[model samples]
Every structure is written in structure tokens, then in C-alpha cells.
Target: MPELLIDIPSTFVERIERLAAEENESLEDMAMLLLRRGYDFAVTRPEVEPDRSQRPGARSDARLDWWREARFGLFIHWGLYSVPAGVWKGRDWPGIAEWLMYRAEIPVQEYEKLAAQFNPVKFDAKAWVSLAKRAGQKYLVITSKHHDGFCLFDSAVTDYDMVDATPFKRDVLKELAEACAAQGIKLGFYYSQTQDWHHPDGDGNDWDFDPAEKDFAGYIEDYVKPHVRELLTNYGPIGIIWFDTPKGISEEQSRSLLALCNELQPDCLVCGRLGNALGDYATAGDNRIPEEVLDLDWETPATINDSWSYKINDHNWKSSVDLIRKLVDIVSKGGNYLLNVGPTGEGVIPQPNVERLEAMGRWLEVNGEAVYGTQPGPIQGRADLRTTSKEGVIYLHVFDWPADGQIRVEGVAAQGARLLAGGAALPVEVSSGALVISVPEEAPDEAATVIALR
Candidate 1:
């Protein structure tokens, strides 16, 4: 189908204006709806959703079709950093544990010794996948190789990998992939494309390897590209290749790797950090969500706790209510939420993270229709009420439930309304250009109450 270019007739404009006035929507918004009606496709008010995914453009968008629908994902950051647990020299280190190597300024020789102690005996891939699945995450992205150059998967390129170096000589990634497949969850790899602190030719090791002596291109060809090839071919149908930290990768260098990924798995999406701004979907700033609705498929990677990796001292965990609200906010803005959990050295998800995930899962069990496979509603920027629509039904996610029985939707008209948590009919009235949904005095869920508007 061609793009939806609305060329409304002069006579139709008057009719649309009346309808817009009735719905409290802009005349232009109603006109877009009329235009899209002639051709079936979703249209966002204020701005029409462009056919960036299907039309002739970057191949990334084409592959992002499934990702947009996913809406939620699990991000695992586990490695030797888990061994440190944010402690260096018996002193508590601050910030993310994944940055342990750089933060503590540990040399390659000393850091290599930690692998011998890297025995995650309790690490069960099935359990991890099950946890993520229960949390209602459509996909899981684990750190295959972080900036520290410690490989979780069996890598032929270096002896620094789990299989080659670790005491628990099992391929963490292989098990994770198999487990994800068995549990019917999509899996992706978060490979550190640049800034391999352990490798001499890799970026971000000025103390160990001199920049002048390092061969950046050779590092890409020998280690980075080949390792990526191994991951793609070995893993069964990867959803994404999440490359992170663009230290020194040029545009051409990044494209070369993306091309390799495309050749291997045509549908595999690349992270936005895959330097040169070439990726399947846009990645929002770490732990940051959009202020308003976004037309493109973007994702916000958030940590369950203060640190991406486990820290004994980092007790600051996001409450269940906060996580649920964040999820709702991201979904309302037409974006996916990739919540991170850093496992302990023993490869255990912290108890706090587990509890919060279960809580979110329970909420999703009831009000999932408002999230999964839903598109952004016509209403864009509003904190009090966010919108997401599926088919013709619009979902009003009320952040602050109305104290009074009457719930007024400023610019929406609903045929009928029902509270999502419980199948109770919400008395709905379509007044002059507004939708009023009647609810109980007390809100069902304090976090975010969803009302289904048809």
C-alpha cells in the first residue's frame, strides 16, 4: 500500500471540523483519521505515523516490526563484575558494577585472575528465562561480552572466555539461548563492540595498550567481527545484536559489522549504539524515557536497582509501583522498556528485583491489553492521562485515579468504558467533545488504573 497522504475535499473539511469539535480533537487530527480510514493504517494526532518501517529506507526499521510490538524486555548484566560486586581493594566502589575494571583501574593481569573464581554454580539459564517470562518480558538481552572483555559465551577468538578460563567451564550464552527457546522467549546479545579493556588492539585501555600502537581496524576484523559471526551463527534466531559503547568505531566500521549481522540473520535488529546512527530502532538515553509520544520504535534500558550489575551496597531498588508506572509510560509513548537486572556472583537475581518483577507481572496479567501489541493513542503529551489504542478501542491510563466517580477524558469520545483490572462497567457519558468514564470512589490500582474505551 502507498503512503497515506490525506487530500481532503473542501466539503469533507466542514464535516470533519464538526467531528473534531465533537471529539475535542484538532480539525487536522480528525482529517488524518478520515484519510487513514480510506486506507487502513494507524495515525497519531498532531503527527501522522510515517511508513519508516516498510517504505524504502534503512533496513533496520524493516526488521523492527516485531520489536515495536514486544514493548518490554529483560536486560542481564553479569560477568566478573559480579565477582567484585562493586568492591575494589576491600573498599566500596560507587556506580555500575559493569564498569569495575575502569573504575578500579585494574590492569589486564590482575583482572584475568578473577575468572578462576568466576564460578556461578547456581546460575540456571532456565530459571533466569522463566523469571523474565513471568515478568511479562517479550525478549531477553544478556551481556555476551561486556567492556571488560570477559566472554560469557564460548569464544574461539580469546582464552579470556568462560569456557576457556572460568572454573565453571560452561557456555552461559548457549544455555541461555536454549532456555529462552524452550520457554518461547526471544533472545538477544549485548556485545561490547568497542572499548575492550583487555584486548591490546581494542579501544579504552590507554593504561595497558598505547593508542598509537593499537590497530583499530585489525581489532574489528580479527576479534569483533569474528566474535559477532560466532554469536549469530551459534545462537538460534537472535532478535537483536545490542552493540554498546561507541569509543572509536567509525561509520564505515559500524556499517561493516551491521552488514555482517544482516547477512547472518536478516531480521536481527541492531542497537542504536552501533555507531554512525545506523540501527533498527532508536535507543533512548540510559534510564530515560521520552517526554511525549514517539512515532519511531525506541527503547529505554532501565536498571532495576541503582547499579546495572549487582552491588552489595547498592540497595536502591525501584519499587513495584514505580516500575509499573514506567512501563505504562514507555508503552504509552510507543516504545519498549528493557529493564535490567544484575545477578550476583553466584548468578542469582537479587530478591528485591525478583519481587518487583513478579508484582509487575501480576499487573500485566490483568491489564496487558493496554500494553502488548498496542499503538500510541491520538492524545500525545499528558502526565495525568496517557493513551494507547488497539484495533478501535482506546485505553485511558489514568495515573491519578479521580476521587469523584466521574473520569473526564478531555478530547476523547468512547462508545463504552470498562475498568481493566476488574470486568466492571464504567458508566460512560459522551458529552460535548469529551468522554466521561464513571469509576468507583477508590481506585482499583494505586499505580496506574486503566480504562478500556471502545
Candidate 2:
């Protein structure tokens, strides 16, 4: 008999051996059983090549055309942290709800207890995807694994996942993937590559593990890489692998992760947080937009409220008017708006979040032409006014409707002007190298009113 060798992470090998014993089968037969369950032993290229080439120490634009044109997307941050909802031992932590573990410095054994009670019976994949679609989001990104190191999908590498550990026993990511496909929305995963508080060797667990003795490289090889591989392999086609908190990740480690994404799903985009400026696009700070237009492709990830994860007391929701205006501002500055929602532990999006999204959807139904597939307009540096352009037409987004019924747009030569909401032409005149247009005394929409000029 000849011997065949397969090199994989030790964790997977242990899983296979354990299964072999439980099933009363040979090791090879157990390996075959695992393979039959859709386990990919090796990385293989898909039929189509990536859109852009990747070079060492350089970021590749690879398949971001749809992302750039999308203009807006949905970000979901759901995990065990949602179960706590930002209160630890009856004390409400005041910050991002997801950082409850790190902020309070809870013990691993105690924090892991949340898994026993983690059951989101109300989670509806179809409904979630439909909401994103209704909100005019072209793509969706969910946190597959956050800093707490909780896994939302079934992993052969570990059992501390939604399926095995939690009472829900359902793979949330799998359901979301199917729903996204059915709804025609691109899917992306947010994985915390560097910070895994649960694991002893993983970064950000100083309370449990001695940092001096921890083998960070070993953790990357055994845990992080395996999880990333599992994500790319199990999912049908991932749009983006959004990594967060690079902290102490080495340049070599970042490149290695990039190589894995390239090898498995070349079309999948790697965001800048993967570290060392090797992402297809740059990501702005949380809830922070750039002051000026960045030369490279960038996106601003913002929360619907102040918290990224669900917080019972965090009622400070941004108004629909402010959110709509924020969307216009980001697009005008040549960036994508990744609006986030923190669903309750019961799997229901807070009603306020739903209402805001619906309102934005209604706003988009009439003014989508001004937003979708548009470029940053020629006009810049105005707080009350922002602009987006498609083809030769420019869209003037008036956040603060001029009460005087007259507005002046600089550096534009307009032959005609009309309201996008009503298609009613307005009077226009040229004066002092600017186009002055007459408007209604009252704005049609409270959020933002658009004027199309050509």
C-alpha cells in the first residue's frame, strides 16, 4: 500500500482523528468523510481570473467596480456581544457595545458562558436581506468573527461557533449567504484577523495569556489562517474579506493573508485594515469621514446610532435627514457609505433602524438616478450643498433648502435645470461665472432635495 500526504492545520487533523474514532472508521476514511462534507483540502483557481494583477507590497484594485458604483452598503455587527447588549453585571459600559469584553476585562470562562444563552430565534435571513435591498444597498457585510473570537458559522477548526456552542444551532453566515444570493446582493465578511480575545495565543487576551510566552506566529498558522480558509471555501463567492484592528500584525503576515485571499477567491476584495496598505481600497475611521477627497478608493463605516453592537440604552439615533445628508456628503467627496445596524439578540433590527432605512429607501426611489453609478461632482467645499454627477449631468443635493428661493452654483455652465423629485424645470441664469437657479420656497423632501443640471 502507498501513502498519501495532506498538510493542513493541526486543529483540523485532530478533528479528523476524533471523527475517525467516533465513527469507527480508518483515518483515511474519516478524511474522506470530511471531504464529502464540502471540506476543501487545497486551494484552486476559479474559471475567471481576477480583474487586476497583484504585485508584492502593492494593493490591487482587483474587482471593485461594483463596490465603487454601489455608493451605499449595509454593515451588520452581530455576535455574542449582542446578547449582553452592553451591560456587564448590571453596569452599563459607555462606549461601542462590541468592546464590552475588552472594556470590562471579563474573564474568558465567564464571558464564554454567554454562548449557552445565545439563541436568536427571531433571526430571519430573507427579511434581513430584503431590508438591505429595500434600503437600496447593493451589498452587505456581516461580522463573521469579531475581536471576541466568536464564530458565526460552523468551523471544522473549532466548536466555539454558532452551530456547536450556541443553543440556536444554526449557521447565521450560511443563511445570510443564501439570502444574499437570492436577493442579488453581494456578500462580504468582516473577520477580526489580529484580535481574538478568547484564544490564549490570539492577540488582545493579556488578562488570560502571558504575552511574553505567546507564540503569535503559531496562532496565525493554526487558527487565523484556517478560519480564513474555511470562510473562503465554504462561502459560494465572497465580495470582500474585511479585516479589522491590525495592531501588531507584521507586514509579512498581512501579505500572507492577502496571498490566501488571492489564491482562493481572487475576485474578493481585501480592505485596508488587512494592514500595510495592501488592500484594494482604504477604509476611513469609524463614524468619521475624511475632510478632503482621498485620491484612492475609500469608504466610511458609520453606525446607525452611537454603538456598533446592540445597546439597550444607546437610543441616540441619527435622524433620517442627517443620515440622508451624510450619504450625499460621502458620495460628493468620492466615498462609499457603509451604514451599520446592530440587531437585537432576538434577531430583530431595532425599529428605529428599520424606520430610518425605510425613509432612506423612499428618498432613493425618486432620486436614485442622481446617486447610483455617479462620480464626485465638480462642486466642492460646501456644507449646505453637495453634488454627484453621471455622464454629463450634475446633481445638486441641497441639504439646507434655500429659504430665499434662489441658489447660486459655482463653476458650472448649465443649459437646463430641473428637480429630480418632480422633473419640474426651474429658472436659470448665468452671473459672475456661476449658475444661479430658482427653487421652491419649501423643499419637496425633508432629507435632501436634488436638482439635475446639464
- Candidate 1 per-residue lDDT, tens place, 55-153, comes to 225434546767777899999999998998999889787668888788766889999999998999999999999999999999999999999999998
**lDDT for position 351 in model 2:** 95
Report every candidate's CA lDDT: 0.84, 0.87
lDDT of 2 by residue, 388-454 (tens): 9999999999888887898898889889999999899999999888899999999988888999999
Off by over 4 Å in 2: 1-62
- Model 1: runs farther than 4 Å from truth? 1-62
lDDT for model 1 comes to 0.84
Clashes of each: 0, 0
TM-score of each: 0.86, 0.86
